[model samples]
Target: MVKRVGIRDVAELAGVSISTVSNALNRPGRVSDELVERVRAASDRLGYVPLQAAQQLRVGRSGLLGMTVINIANPFFADMVAGAEDAATAAGLRILVGNASDDIAKELDHLELFERVQVEGALVSPFGPVDAWQERLRKRGVPVVLVDAVDDAGVMPSVSLDDVAGGRLAAEHLIRTGRKRLAFVGAREEVRQVRERLEGARAAVAAHPGVALEPIWTSTATTQRGLAFGDELADRRPEDRPDGIVTSNDHLAMGLLHGLIARGIRVPEDIAVVGYDDIEFAAIAEVPLTSVRQPAREMGRAAAEILIARINGTETPDLTNVVYQPELVIRASTSTAR
Candidate 1:
């Protein structure tokens, strides 16, 4: 077996002191350019990869920012991760991603892992209240930033969409297009985003007399749950059925659309459909979906900036809570005609 080369070997080959090699690798500005080049050349020749763990211990903090999301497989989270990666790269830092899968225990486990790793900071979309964990991290001098989740504690910075505005937009559009009976298909109202969205929908529904708003709550946000809800709605008497449907996210909307199609119910003709997140697949659905576009990438970038600022000893502005407005993307799914 080939043995791994060490920095000592590179230092010997480059005729430099171990301290000089360390300075060249970690703090290049502390060493001359000529020496840095020589050390780098020797390192390359010896195939020496710096020990990140040792370097992190020596520096007291790793240049790694941990990010925890509910669902890594969701396109919305994937887009956010891409944006975070770009931002972290530009800042000369790295990101460590973790998936909580919407489980409180899993979320806590990831937080514990980040604490053990001594990550510079963390960005999290909590599965539930993380107030206690936030306090523990703060006591340990670890900064935390919330992403796609509201920070009611006002102790942590956060980046999220104006879900209430998004809900109002969808409902208003449906009402303007003469849709009176509307249904909202989504996860439980306990979730902050879902609750805020429902609030906006209710506000819109209140403005127009005779307009009815129905809530179709589900325990899960999976496609199967959406399909089941759709199947049930399709069986409703025509007069009792909703004329328009607003889903919490694009994934649920896609499943509902498929179920509707399978039941021979034409989109926009019999039931107009609108969804949130405006994921890539939303536009590619059989009948291109109308959706509310969340600034997922922007949220990711902002979260990184906040965490980086905190890590760099800069006075992170007071728990900044950025709530970007959602835009309406009209497509065939919500058109007036089939």
Candidate 2:
């Protein structure tokens, strides 16, 4: 029978004590960087796989982390997950993800599930106020970090994009291109991101006197909703349609573009469109979409880092709120016709 390579072998190969090897693998941040690298290299070369059950027993905590998002189907959230996974793996931990699919009940259910499993920590991209959940987890001695949302009370750490700035960038670009009649398509005001974006767009329009922003509220910020809005707009008289449009996300904008083009409406020449998030599909659309880019992946990584620090009882000062700026990526969808 072949014997498994153990931590003792790794310690011997790395010229480190067993305690140093364990700390390097299990509590990387607590150990020196050079020693951690040496231990990792030795472990990799020896194919050493730590006994997870024994480690959990010894440490009194699982090696697993939990992440819940509003919708994993959305490319933005997908990117965030990738980033979080990368960070977690680097710290010698694994993540389990739950997709709420924008359901509050499901969101809570997932939180309960994570709690039942006793995750070391959790990162949540909550659909609504998470104070209750955060409190519940705190009582259970689990750390939680908010992803893509901010808690004004500052009770929990959070990482998010400057959505208002993204909205302003989208609106300002349209206005600069002489698009006077602009329309904003997004979900209800109850959604913080949508509300913030609309607020920013409104501010941008206010700065440009002649630019009027028409608010088109939807039940959901999805491709289907965007398509429905597009169809509705197509039925309107040409004179009544806005010259420029900004949707809350790339999927919605792509759907809108498809709906408009199918009805023989010329993009840019007639109506320019910009979307938020700058998702992957934005570049491959019939007419590539112009969009405001949010650093979704980086936000996820940052949120996970904060949660992990809290989980490890490591002091992280003044990192309660981390907000990233947005950038505008111009494409054919919003390029003005000569």
Candidate 3:
């Protein structure tokens, strides 16, 4: 095998000292323009690939950001990752992603990996409590920004949707369309975002005197579970069944909607449905679903930008939270006689 060329080879070719070569390649601002150009030209000619890990260790910087998401299967999270990648690329940095799949143990393991890698910062979209892990990262000088979540103490910056507003919007729309008995189907009460949505729906129901709200708990927000719930609801008497349903996610909502339509239930006429995260499939499902739109990509980009700002030491005290309001997308799923 050919001998691997090192920075020393590039320095020799450029007629510069090893320290000058290092500064020109890693921190260009420390060297002159002519030296940087000459060093880069020599590096290109020699095919010298610097060991980034060793260089980062020497300089106390990695130029890498870490990201953790609850579930990669969700389209919303995927879109968020794309948005974050946009910002990371623009800043001349790279991101390392860890998919926790909604498990706290996996999430912890990812955090530990981030620590070991000496990431400059992290974009954490947690499924459960992780303040302790976040604190540990902070102690290690890794600035963290929350994505799709907020620190109750307002210490860490965050970019997220107003989930309570999203839930309220769904419930109010159903009430406007004359849906009285309504049910909310969601999973994982331990998740903060899901709980906030339920709180919003409950608030909306309480405001309407004649309306009644029922809460349904499930294992996961999957299409299969939604279908099962739909069958169970359709089997009840007309008077006993909910007139409308609000779901935690599009997957469950779409499945539940499919289940209802398959069971000879007239959607909207029988029971209207609304879902969250107006994902792409929500618009083209068997029955177009009315959903609350969360600007997932935009939220992710915003979170990454904030994290970059903090890492660069340019963040302001009040730039800690950025919350976007949810918009309702009305579709045939909730429209009458469509």
Full-model lDDT for every candidate: 0.87, 0.89, 0.92
| lDDT-sorted candidate list, best first | 3, 2, 1
lDDT of 2: 0.89
Residue 136, candidate 1: Cα error in Å is: 1.1
Name the regions of candidate 2 deviating beyond 4 angstroms.
1-58
Q: Candidate 3: worst 10 consecutive residues by lDDT?
A: 130-139
Estimate, for each residue in 254-324, the C-alpha lDDT of model 3 and write its tens digit: 99999999899988889999999999999999999999999999999999999999988898766779999
* Colliding pairs, model 3: none
Clashing pairs in 2: none
lDDT of 2 by residue, 175-251 (tens): 99999999999875677888899988999999988789999888887888877788898999998999999898888
What is the C-alpha lDDT profile of model 1 across 162-280, one tens digit per residue?
88999999999999889999999888566788888888999999999999999888887877777777798889888998999989988889889888888888888899999899999
Runs in model 3 with CA error above 4 Å?
1-50
* Clashes (candidate 1): 0
Winner on lDDT between 2 and 3 is: 3
Model 1 regions lying over 4 Å from their true place: 1-48, 315-319
| Whole-model alpha-carbon lDDT for candidate 3 | 0.92
